[model samples]
Target: MSAVESSARRLPLVLRNPSFGRVWAGQLLTQAASRMFQVGAVWWLVGFAGGSHRGLDSGLFLMVSTLPAVGLAPVVARVVARHAHRTVLAGAAAAAGAVAAAAALLARAEALPMAAIYAVGLALAACQALFDPCLTTSVPELVEDADIESATGFELSTQSVAGLGGGLLGPLAVDAGGLPGVVAACAVAYLLAALLVRSARFPHATARTGGGSPSDTAPASRTLRQVLAGLPFIRRVLVCFAAANVFTTAVYVVMPLYTRGVLHSTGSTVASLEAALGVGTLVGSFTGARVPGRPVAVGSVCLIVMAAALGLPGLAAGHAVALGALCVVGWCVGVIGVRFVALFQRLVPADDKPQFFAVMQALLGATFPVASLVFGALGDHLSARTLCLVQGVGLVPVALALRWAGGRTDAEELPGSATQSPARAREAS
Candidate 1:
């Protein structure tokens, strides 16, 4: 096990690609900032609203942070695809930094209204609409095709590490620096993410484009239409992408209920569950380098494993059992998410990556509020264990459907996709 684990820690190979290293480092900072932001934001909102309708306030705030960004994704994706990833990403980060700074100032003054805070959250989310896709799509740009998976793994690992740190340190940050300090810290993080990635090149930005000519008056509508043109392909091959996001979001919605009501555990125990999952995910991100299969297929298989693992929490008789099951779930999340995203990077046209990711993100965001409300409301009447069971069982067919669709579409699109060729295919139908 030790020898196998040592082999999995191939951090040097990825870092050797300086461009990728900078992007990876920047990604880590931004991801950590996101966690910090969430912690600080949730705490502040909870404090401000007090007891009554606290659930509504918290859920609405969380949903607001994500939903508004969806409408802006198509535009964000278009910009990212048309311009250099570095430019769009840096700009977005700078914008977010500015917003965070303003929010920090408001927080320091204790003048931040819920509306203002929600607006700032919306602004940050909008910036992410641009920054997120560029960051992911830029990975393939920075690394060689053979190392794409590693690069993708490195990216997901950033989230795991951030999650661990954010959930752990967020409260401490709030107590030490207060909400203002946390927001300020996030500002600094965004700025750092921008500065780091600014020097990185985006080779894929040079792909075929309708713009960039000196004489041509590039029409915005035309560019948008071209960007939206990839929807058909995305729909056919990525049926489960949105479903996966919904399930993952549902887990977040359900996790707390399970901890408090079902396990009769304290808040710290909820934190522990998140920490366990983060650790498990971190391990998976590195070791999954040897997962040994096509990313789409491997990802599909991992989803099934994750779904199975999710079902375990429902049956778990105690905290330890549930904790172990969550770790398994996290491992699957780490492996499968990277695989699916790497496949997205590989299969989509270099120019259309921004569009593809944006649309998907938008769709996922659209569901965040709906899923949160549905789960939150249902949790009132149904047992958390029952909810977990339903969510777990529900995902199995989605995984299978994704796998079957991928196989058929990939085989049709790529010549030798009989093995894992489906992922390599540029377009299906």
Candidate 2:
């Protein structure tokens, strides 16, 4: 058997299955490459900025990079539903590769102004914003409803593996080539990913029995008013999602500061810790996929555990002890990440999936800037340990919120709508 098939055979039944295996492999490589680019980009910025007087912090740069994606996600979502999912994805991947290549060239010439970087970053985000829903929507086509949970879990596991590889490898590219090398590495990865994902053969979209074409059978196209009407469900999901983002954002911003200032760890140690989190996430993805009933509850527990784990360093005897605790925290974070997306898929309407997912992404995107400001202030006032402790404490309300949301929904809410054509076409009926 080929290596991919042999690897599949060694996995669980769901993962070993033919169709799901391809989807899983595609996601695994894509996520790994994406993270590699992220690290590479950050390294590139460090080189480009090149001075004690450099204006933008990495957190702020990331915030700017993501904000455009959030704002434009609705537009991206509409594009995904209007065309073949893979077609849209392939195009986006190609666009991403082109942007990465351009960024690399610019970095080499030292012509990579902050504005230019932000513009490229915006283009990259636009590509990624549609990626989640497109892939999630494709799952129903690839596997039966009974197999979806397993498929979701496997996808999450793949992401964790990718995240780990990207995390470890990204910094190395930066070390070797500085900003230019990092950009080249990211461009190459994106090109490879685009090629791999583009080549995969997925089932064609078709209407159900007795229905017309899937597009024609889709719910009437929503008007601006109708689209806005989806706000309630969107709101419910966004609130909890926003809360979770806040918690994670705090960690993302503070983790580096903690290692550098408090733990006195090296960059290598920090990268390893990140990879550890990916490993934890991979483990959590499988467990989450297999867990029955109340995906939100599982997520809640993960949030609580992640929150508690952050405080483990308080009991640590030294830096090494603290690093060990951070590793455990990373595992919890990974599990929560998988559940975060799964719960959204469970809750949104099929037709509204793109818009709703966009809203969530917008909220998530918004939170980073907010966290930067909030934690930046907190850092000024408190010790890094105290800041971590406060973040842990803040998660209590979020954990409670998840528990509350989990109990409110019916089993068949079905995240997507029945129709998803041109909003005007949908409205004609």
Candidate 3:
């Protein structure tokens, strides 16, 4: 009874802390807005623009939109290191809102060109490139050191929930509001997110370390050399991340095609399968927060499970089994995401996190688009079943590569004779 009562009392304490609660809310709103806007954009493209509603193709548009952000990430990261975090974040939010507004207008005109849509995606991505580093680094300021891990868990959970909830809401909103309505709703979410950041209970900008200003007034000078130093760790993580993305992207390219072409499933069933993944992600996020061992090991398991889930459609004797497999895959992806963030936090320092994260996002921009392009082209020649089999089999090599990358120790180590955190040391050896 004492343990149960004690646990009950502690849960509220975790939630009630003002700083954690505020940041948690901010993350939730940001993710919610992202998912809704993303889904709505795809729906608009397919329904209004006569494009495919599939994620891989739609993801191309989204990825192209984000390219500028990826291109400017290193520079923006340096700027973030010199300026007030709040100032940059507020500006980023405003810019993102503007992009969303542009998207809304284009959809309303019903004359949205692929080029025009891609342009909006670029603007939105750039704004996010600036905003993300500020937010990730803000965690230390919001809570004491002891609370950082819990805060990470809280942030991950909120993001997962927001994504799942907003994804569910997006189609419903689209039915009621049309393409224009969907964009408007997303714009509102961003605007509200901006306001929330401005009023949130974070520490003063002066207290923060990263996200420096462009004017170069601050003492934390992160030069190209300093930034370059993070490459080894970055290289290690990217191997895993990129491989996983390629495999996943290849599989997703065929899901709808397989659903309709092979299984003869209804459109609604495909939608349900997609939504089930989102729900799985939400569940996985909460569960990932409790993982006891190393993050990479945990992430690896999650990734492999996701890969298997992706392949299940090929092996499942029927439609119902396929749906179940997809849901499991989705849950694993949610779990992988939380570990991904924690891994990022471990590899980079407080000041350079944005820059490093930007590198990752940039790779995402560059790689996924190319991967999608290849997969789309490949689909013309390959059977969906054959593609799934290849991707599933390919997962083994990719996983091995990632594991090897993570385990590889450079001849040189971090400067200052760093005592690696338990997490870092695990893979380093």
Candidate 4:
């Protein structure tokens, strides 16, 4: 093959589109900065609490940050429906940068109270709640239909890459110049993301809501009705994803206990397990688009594999086995997550995409914090191994249920199917 052919084969088709490439680059920076901000803020909060009620403070901070996804999603959906994709993306990024900069300035002056930090976190989280769904909905508009899956795969990979980047960079920044350095770094990232997105083109011709469309002027009630009408097709998959998150969250609660109680290990072992999981997720993200099948079916299989991986650590007698199991869990999650995102992109109408993704963010976001709390409470009464086994067993039924519920033909899942009226489609768009 010629060098050009080899290069074409090696590169992701979506990235060849300059507009998408810029937007993707912005996503990378924004996500990494978000991670860094999370790390720096949490670490600072813990230390500032002086080890008294440290866990409670940290937990509350995380919950506060997450609440926006659930509470503000409806409002965000409306905002998204009324604005251009590029406008929303750029504005959110700018808002995040401004918030980070304010936090950094306050921290430098030693005037950063816990309450103030919480407020900053809430602001940043709200920005993210707006930014993420808009970005997800923009993918199809940015790339050709044929490249959507590959684009989704690349987008999903951003989290793993950001996780690894933040894990490494967060500590270095903290060590070099403490919380101020990290927050400053985050501000720079957010601003850069804003600039990149501001310059990128989002074609208005294919847009569903903005550009003075009738749907842009539609009442919130009608929008809600449209979203509700489409729920039955996707609810099963959403439930399955949420249920799987229970097991995933349990890892955070159970891993430390499992390490100390079962493996008789230390913090280094925990770090190793985390690193393994991150590496596996990175690998899985790159490969997810290549796996051939209907996305929903493939995601179901991935959920099953993930459930088994979660349970494996409980049955393992050595650290290596547990490590391998977590790696598998991460890989399955990465694959299934990409598939689900791509599936939603295909299934949802363009106008309803924002609301759909917001609902998704809320569903997935709620699972982690709530499940972690429940698992933490349970850990007080149960062995880590037993809890792991129970979580694994619990997800089997959810996974199977998703497979059963996903039996509808692809035609039925689209917007203008027999079950939907032409008038309703027109109103929705």
| Root-mean-square deviation (CA) per prediction | 7.2, 8.2, 5.9, 7.0
lDDT of 4 at 26: 87
Tens-digit lDDT track for model 4 on 1-429?
999867875776645677888888888888888766665555454333344444445555666666787888769878887788898999999999999998889889895777887798788888988888788878887876767898897887677887767645654576567778888998999999999999888763265443675647865533534775655757666777787787676565566557655787544565566567788887777688888776767877887888888888777767998889888887887787677777677567777776667567767888867765676566556777887798789888888887776774344456656776654332211
Off by over 4 Å in 2: 1-26, 43-56, 139-156, 201-241, 263-266, 288-305, 312-319, 334-366, 376-383, 397-429
Clash count per candidate: 2, 17, 11, 0
lDDT of 1 by residue, 25-99 (tens): 777777677766765565544343355444445566667777746777557656876787788878888888889
- TM-score winner: 3
Tens-digit lDDT string for candidate 3 (293-358) = 666567666767766776766666467766777678777776777776766665556777655565
Where does candidate 2 have its weakest 10-residue lDDT segment? 420-429
lDDT string for model 2 (1-429, tens) is 899867865677444565556545556655676667655455444334554422135555566556755576567667866787667766766777788898889888886766776676667666666665677777766665656787776764565578788877776676677667766776776676667667765654453123455567566655434654544433555677687677666665565556555766544655666676666666665566665444566667877877787766544535665556566666665566565576555444467666555555566778876775577556545666887778778888888887776566432333234543344222111
Question: For model 4, which pairs clash?
Answer: none
Q: In angstroms, give how far residue 382 of model 2 lies from its true place.
A: 5.9
TM-scores of all models?
0.68, 0.70, 0.71, 0.68
Off by over 4 Å in 4: 1-19, 39-54, 137-156, 175-177, 201-237, 250-275, 285-308, 311-322, 338-361, 375-429
Full ranking by TM-score: 3, 2, 4, 1
Tell me which of candidates 2 and 4 scores higher on lDDT.
4
lDDT of each: 0.69, 0.62, 0.64, 0.73
Ranking by lDDT: 4, 1, 3, 2
Candidate 3 least-lDDT 10 residues: 46-55
**Residue 183, model 2: Cα distance from true site in angstroms:** 1.3
